[model samples]
Target: MSIAKKLVGQTAAYGLSSIIGRVLNYLLVPVYTKAFLPEAYGVVTYLYSFVALFNVLYTYGMETAFFRFANKPGTDQRELYNKVLSLIGSSSLIFTAILLLASGPIANFIGFPERQEYIVWLAIVLAIDAIATIPFAWLRLQNKAVKFASIKLINIVLTVGANMFFLVFCRQVYNGDYLPELRPWVTSIYNPDFGVGYIFLINLVANALQLPLLWKELSIFRFRLDVDQLKPMLRYAYPLLFMGLAGMVNEVIDRILLEYHLPDNFYPNMSNMAAVGIYGACYKLSIFMSLAIQAFRYAAEPFFFSQANDKNSPQAFAQIMKWFVISCAFIFLFVSAFRDEIASVFIDESYHSGLVVVPILLLANLFLGVYYNLSVWFKLTDRTQFGTWISVGGAVVTIMLNLLLIPVLGYVGSAWATLCCYFAMAAVSYFLGQRYYPIPYPVRSIIGYIVLAVVLLLGVFYVPVQQVWLNYLIGLVVCALFLVIVAARERLLFFNK
Candidate 1:
């Protein structure tokens, strides 16, 4: 089978599970916004952004190491799996215990002194998630996409279901006159003061429950550590650990910064927390692009490692990168064209103010996706420190730009910061990747498609179509035309007529 075919097949399986599953999960954005005020929603967004950072810290790049080391010829996969699991499990327990012990001080430090249990609950979920990271990576290594997708979807379903039950059903039971008998029972569990805390609480239950379901992946390993293999794996992954933290900074530091940089007085009657809530909701409008890139990474990472020795792998990577760029460009245009529609529905109208940044964030994520493709070079060559340096560069830019801009332009500044950061990261990664790994990516064709997409996007932005249907029609036609042009240029469409 062609590598393209195999890649598409794997990407489809992963996409179905991750992209579709995440979109389904993303539906909760509306549920959350409807349930919690923007200030409360801001708190949820704030804590979860920290969670993303901490998650990277807890996993410490071990998952990628598992993929690389477990695939080595003559290596015992079972033994490697056991060690990886042991390392993550023990570290997660220690991390969780420490956090739980100091939950109060940490909560107070973060200005959430009253919600000390929030820290404790988050620690529990984080520990479970940290430990589960290895087993999930093990499944991906084994090419168990079906199982992977199933387990991921199950977790999503559980989380979403719990969220709806608590936020919707419980609210109905508590507020409605029909449930007179059940009102007190529902009211007992539902605290208006708890607000968005229930969101995290539901996630905790979901994360905890999903671990037991991953017993197949976890059950094989006893609690024994392999010191020798552990050392090399740590050596390999520690650099990636820094890369992960820096990369996360590039990804989510805006959310974190929006809360701190934009104070209550930043805007008349607009709390920084509310701005964050609005920014977080509007950010969800770009999930179409994020979901695609995430699904691609899920399939691509393992696929890249497996094909490391193939003589044609470089050519294949170039081809894959082209398709990825074109696909991401299509998503960018699709979402940008209907940005208002998605934002309007993604959450309440209160979030509509931040919708203007959707296009910027979408384009930023496109660059980030390209960066992900370029990153394969460092990972494949074990030059993982390059990854760390690149991410740190991006992180520095993210911080500097956010610090300089947020007070002036608000979240829009953060959006521009993200776009600039990813563009710089992609450019740097490509320059270094060519020198180090030297994949023959089709530069001209890729540039042509990108230029075309951006032209269309700019045209649409400047020339607003009053009719919604007309706007969508134009977007679809442009998207179709781009695909046709790509196929004709590559001779996949119209052929030797």
Candidate 2:
């Protein structure tokens, strides 16, 4: 098969799980909003933001490291797998213990002293999920996308099921909508006092459910350390640890910072949680873009490492970057054009005010996706520290921007900070990639595509049609025009009919 076809197939398998999994997760937003207040939902968002950071620390770049070493000629795949599993397993346990011991102090520091269980639950969730990372990466390496997708789908289903059981069924029973006989059972299990805590509990339960499926991956008995082998792997992965952490900071710290830095005076009538809730809801509008990026990353990382030795690898990478950019652009235009309709699908009315940032966030994610593609340069060349520098710079951008702007512009400022950080990161990565591992990245054409997308998005925004149907018709026509122009300009690949 052609490399393009293989990439598409692998990406489709990964995307099926990623995109479908996220869409299903997205469908739960309305349920969460209904079951918990904006304040409560905001708390959920806040804790998960911390989870995002902790997840990186817990896994600590082993997944990528595993792929890098495992794909090499001299490395023993079995020994590599055993050492990685043992390393993460020991660290995860240790981390979870420390978190548990310090849960009280940490909860207080984070302004949630009253809800220490949130800390405990997240600690457990992160640990389990962290240790499980390698097995999932193993599935990817093995070309078991079907199994990967199935396991992912199952994990999400169990999570959603657990969420519904708690939020939907138990809530109805508590509200006296259910028959009185079932009350005893439901009431014993359900506590109105739990509130958003149930969300955490359900998540912990869902992550735990994934363990039994990985019996084969985990059954090995290689608990002994190989110091010689471990040294180089650690050296290779350490920079990535920094890179991943900073990257996550770019991704999630806005939600965390919003909770802290939001002015008491901004959103005068609403509490901090309310402001955060609004911002968090609108952020969901960018998930489709994230989903696409994640799917591509899953396939691309292993796929790229495998093809690194091929004579045509550079050209292939360049074409992949072009198509990747085009795909992200289409997503940006689609979401920005229909954002009014799309934003309302699962978000509550209270969150509507913050939806203005949806397009900004989508575009930001596009930049992030591009940066990920450019990052292949560093990863391939084993100059991974460059990634650390770029991401750390982005993280600095994130912190400084949030500190400066969140007070004045509220969550909207946070959104702008995100877009700026990603834009800077993508540009910097591209320049760095050119210097170190130059691939003919079609720079002019990529700029043209991005500019055209922005212009079309502006037209969609300003030239608003009155009828909903008419607006959708306009969006479709604009999408077609963008496609035709792109195809006409670059008929070498996508439009070569």
Candidate 3:
């Protein structure tokens, strides 16, 4: 299949899971936002942030290593897969066991002393997901896009269905079906009146469904472990561990810090917690850009490894990067043009304060997508440390900005901090990639798109289109103008035709 066709297919497969999954996930926003108070939702947000952190830790760097060594000559791909799979599996079991035993202390450390069951159940869920990462990675490497996407879609659908049943449908039918299973600790601390245990119970059920689906991928491993190959792969993957942690830190630290910095009196003001919840909810709307980036990363990483030895690999990389730029620019305009409307679907009107942060976060995601494109250079060259340093630098920028600005600017400050982090990271990585392994990317044409997007966005933001339909019409005109500029400057239309 042609690259374009394959990319289209892959995008569709990914879009099926990501877009559909997110649409179902969006159901939870209204469910939680309406069912639970903002403070309660904030606890959900805080714990999920820790889940994101632990996901990075548990999966570590094996996914990338699998892609790297799986393509190398003389490497027993099956054995290599088994080794990493075994490593992640054993480590997850040990870690989950440890967390289970220490659930009390862990809950206390995170200021959830009364909700140790939350810690324990979620730890099990996370470990299962973490262990599944390798098989999922294998599926991607083998281009089993349909099967991969199906499993993902089912997982989300089951999760959403379960959540709805527990949070909505089953609430009225609450019998003594499982009340005895609730521990004294849970009964004492948790309000049985609220019926919040359903969240964890539903997650537990949905994650367990993956075991049967994963059996096919697990069966592919027939070769035994090779300690010799393990050493070098570990050496290569260790830096990536730090890089992943730093990258996630940049992504998640704001939420963590917000919870940490919030004062005791802040809880009485629903607006304060509401602002955070609103920001978190609307931020998920930016998944359009993130979804594209993730889909590309899934395809591109393995594509890069497979083609790294080709004589024209650099040119291929440059071409793909250019098209990625065009597509991302188009997505940015498409999302921004309708964000005023899109924001409403994510939450009730009470959360509208978050609208101001949406464009900034969307633009930040564009920069992040670009950074992901540029990062391939370092990964291919085995200079993984460069990526780590770049992320750390970006994290520093993000931290300092949030620290100085959040108190003054509120959620908008966090938005700007994110923007700065991605912008700086992309800029730094582009320059470093050129120095280490230059690709003659069309800088002038790319900048033209950037400039046009900024100008058009400014017009959308400033122009007074009070009527919702009229504003959408105005946005379409601005978007068309950006596209025309891109076509004219790059002759994209002529070349495609």
Candidate 4:
């Protein structure tokens, strides 16, 4: 099979799992928004922001390093895997232990003194998740897409089901809404005071469940730390650790910043935390773009490494970049065009005020996807320091803009900062990729499609028609126009090949 076709197949498998699983997971948004006030929901948002940052720390780019070293000629893949898992596993235990000992102080520091258990729960979740990374990456390296997808789907399903059982079934029974006879059983397990804490606890349980599910992969793991093998891998990966941290700052620091930096009463009748909650809820609307990026990343990472030695790799990369841009543009246009309807379906009405950021975030994530595609240059050429620098630059932009803009424009400022950061990162990465390890990406065509999508989306938003049906019809027509144009331009690329 052609490289493009193979990638498409693997990406489709991964996408099926990611997109479907996340959609199910996202259903919790409405449940949470309805169950807890915005102020309460904001706690979930805030804590998870920290989780995203620490997750990068726990894995520390070793997954990619595993991929890099394992693919090297004459390397013992099994021994390399053992060393990588052992390093991460031992460190994860130490990290979790420290967190457990300090959970009380950390809870006090975060203003959650009463909920110190949250820290303990998340620490375990982090460790389990960190340990599981190599196993998951191993599955990818072995091209076990089906198994990977199945495990991922099962995790999501279990998480969603556990959430419903606790938040919906237990709460309803405890409140006497239904199943009054089961109130005794529900009362035994459910504590109303736990509130949003159940979200964290459920996640801990779900992640713990993954250990047994991945036993087949984990069975081969034996604790061994080969310093000779470890030093070079660390050299390649430590930069990625910083890069991933900075990249996460670009992705999630806004939520954290919005919580503290947003001015009092900026949204009228809303606390700063409530505004953060609303922003978090509305951000889910951008998952369409994120889903595409994540699926592509899953399949593209290993594929890129495998193809690095190919003579025609540059052309293959260009083709992948073009299609990736096209796919993301469509997601941006579609989601932004129907932003209101989608928000209403998935987010509660109380959280609808922050929906304005959806389009901005969608566009930002589109640029993020492009940056991911462009980043293959640095990864393949082993110039990972360049990746670190670009990400740090992006993080600086994110931090500065959040500090300067949040006070002035509220969460809207944070949204604008995200867009600016990702665009800058993508532009910088593209230029640097050209100078360092050039991939002949279809630059003009990529930009043209993005511009066209933006224009059409704008037209959908600014149409004079006041009728709902008319607006939707206009959206469909414009979307169809985009598809037609793309099909005409790329006719020979897919079908002929």
Candidate 5:
């Protein structure tokens, strides 16, 4: 099959899983809003943010490293996999052991000592998921997008179904037919008092369910560990570990800073989990950008490596990067135009306070996606240190802005910080990539699209009608005009024939 066809097929399969998976996960927002207080859901938000950061730490760039080394000529593919797998497995084993032993101290440090069990179970969950990361990447390397997406979709379905059972159906069952002898079990399950603990429990269970689906991949493993290959892969992966850590800090440090710096008195005085919940819910509004980046990376990473020796490889990479920027800019403009209504999709009315962050953060993620595309040049050239420096710089900018601005402007400051951080990283990567592995990207056209997006965003924000529906209708028309212009420009550039 042609690469284009393969990509189209792979993306379609993965996109279904991604879109469906996000839909299922989005269901949890409403569930939590109705089932638990905003404060309770805030707990869910905080822990998962921490989970995202630690998952990056525990995986430690090995998934990408596995793909890099495993694709090299004359490399023992199986041995390469085994080396990385063993490394991650051993690290996870040790990490889980420590987490189990030190759950109390860890929980206390995070200010939730009473939820040590949460820490313990989730740490195991993270370890399991981390160890599975290599196998998942292997599936992608092997062109197993269907199976890969199947596993992911199944995981999402199981998670969403379990959460519904726990938070919604469980109450209905207890209230209706199952109340007589099951009262204690029902009461234990239906913690009307607790907030968003059920979401974590459901995630833990869903992630556990993925083990059986991954058994086919796991069974391919040989027990042989290759120390010779391990040394080089470790060398390659170490910089990525720092880069990944810095990247995630850019993505999530806002939530961490909020939890740490926000006054304890703010929530109850404000009549709810005001700041955290708002930030958390508004964050979800950017899932469009995240999902687009993820789906593109799934295909693009291996695709780029596979074609590394082609004479046209640089041209192809440039094209891919341009298209990625164009699509992401389009999504940013599209989503931002309708964010006011999109903000209402989550259950709690109070969360609407953070809606303004959605458009800002969506654009930040646009820059972030572009930065990812640019950073790939460093990875492809094996000059990965550039990625580390860029990400660290971005992280520093993100932290400084959050610290300086959050005290004065609250979550909006964090959103603006994210935008600035990503914009800076994208700029740095573009300039540095030109120095190292220059690809003649369509810089003019890409910048044109960005300018068009910004102009349309201004139209949406500045031109407002009192009726919400009319305002949104006008915004959609404005976005469609931009889209039509984009489509015309793309055709003229690529298909003037």
Candidate 6:
């Protein structure tokens, strides 16, 4: 129970930055949706999907490898950190240069030949972010959750500030909306034709600032190549790299597929890019679930490694899983219950047509979180190959389903594909985890909470309440009922410990 408390505390610390930062970032969805047309915003969406994929490649699982090896008995963590940082730093430089050189061709390939600068800016952003991962991982491994959160919050704050400066203030001034006196200053710095390019440029500038903030952590990093240590770490991380790539496929390929496969004029008077923009905007509705998972992961990865040798680890893990699912299930229910309100508040009406997929995407992210929890088995046991295969299988499912359904159902098909893929991965990981690592993960209770959440969400959708206020009252009641049941069942766990 104390272990659970510690994990919860650390997660809360991490969640401070992740949840708040993401909410702030989520605010940008409204700004962007309003500022750019759906087609323009779709370009932003399409390009960033590739950014997510390349980000995995840039670090290539080295952060996880550092954690695994650092915890080994008799290991010198400082030297290990030096080696990991050196390898990533060098590789990032090479990768960034190559991408910069090919920026034009790459932009042309993505159908954005006029915007090669976006590719260049994102390349720099990716490299800086990749190199910074080790320092951040080092912070987590050393249990510096406060410092970690502080740095993350700083980065996001700067990112958000820059975004507002360029997108909101400058754009508005340039358009003569307000502050006409500042138009000359805004014009001197901002190009109205830049359009969505500011998003990438601001991101690059924000990521660049992280290097100075992480200077203390990076100061200890020495430029050294320890080939002997490098070989073993690579062996461990290579599978994870593959797994990460496959996982990215499952996560982002739907956007890519939707961009290419949706029929022209599929929606009434909407192009494929417009549809992609709508899907991307609606997808932001799932940010709460994704943020929760990210916070848990930031704390739980190192926690799992530290607890790997404990005699009672299985029980502790089982309890952790129960609480994690309970929390996520509540998020699922709350978000699904208020999906319409959230959509209206966060995105333009032009994008509201895609709101139907928000619940599906939320549930999919819930299962993705479950899969992350279950994946601790492979990471702890040094059987990362299982993770590789499971993620690949999920990616295959995502692809096949998207291909079969996108033409028929559009972005809705992509949402269902996401749900099916994540559910399948989580199920497979659970069975394989039981066979290998064998944690008693309160499977019955976990399933019960999820099923109950789904049923309540259905009630929220189909309940015969004509008045909006009455409907909101019932949704609140449904959420309160869930909390009441959870508190009643888990009273002993809370009070006893």
On a 0 to 100 scale, what is the lDDT of residue 473 in model 6?
98
Clashes of 3: 0
Instruction: Give the TM-score of each candidate.
Output: 0.96, 0.96, 0.90, 0.98, 0.94, 0.98
lDDT of 1 by residue, 86-118 (tens): 988989999999999999999999889999989
Worst 10 residues of 3 by lDDT: 169-178
Model 2, 133: alpha-carbon shift in Å? 0.8
Scored by lDDT, model 4 comes in at 0.91
- Residue 319 displacement (Å), model 1: 0.7
Q: Roughly what TM-score does model 1 have, to 2 decimal places?
A: 0.96
TM-score for candidate 6, residues paired by index: 0.98
Instruction: Give the distance in Å from residue 338's predicted Cα in candidate 2 to where it truly belongs.
Output: 1.2
CA lDDT of each prediction against the hidden true structure:
0.88, 0.88, 0.77, 0.91, 0.81, 0.91
Candidate 4 structure, TM-score to reference? 0.98
* lDDT string, candidate 6, 32-85, tens digits: 998899989999899999999999999998999999999999999888899999
- Cα lDDT over the full model 3: 0.77
Candidate 5 lDDT over 417-461, as tens digits, reads 999999999999999889988887789988888888988889888
Clashing pairs in 3: none
> What C-alpha RMSD separates each model from the true structure?
2.1, 1.7, 4.5, 1.3, 2.6, 1.2
What is the lDDT for 328 in model 3?
A: 80
**Which ranges in model 1 have alpha carbons more than 4 Å from their true place?**
177-185, 493-497
Top-down TM-score ranking:
6, 4, 2, 1, 5, 3
In model 4, the runs with Cα more than 4 Å from the true position are: 495-497
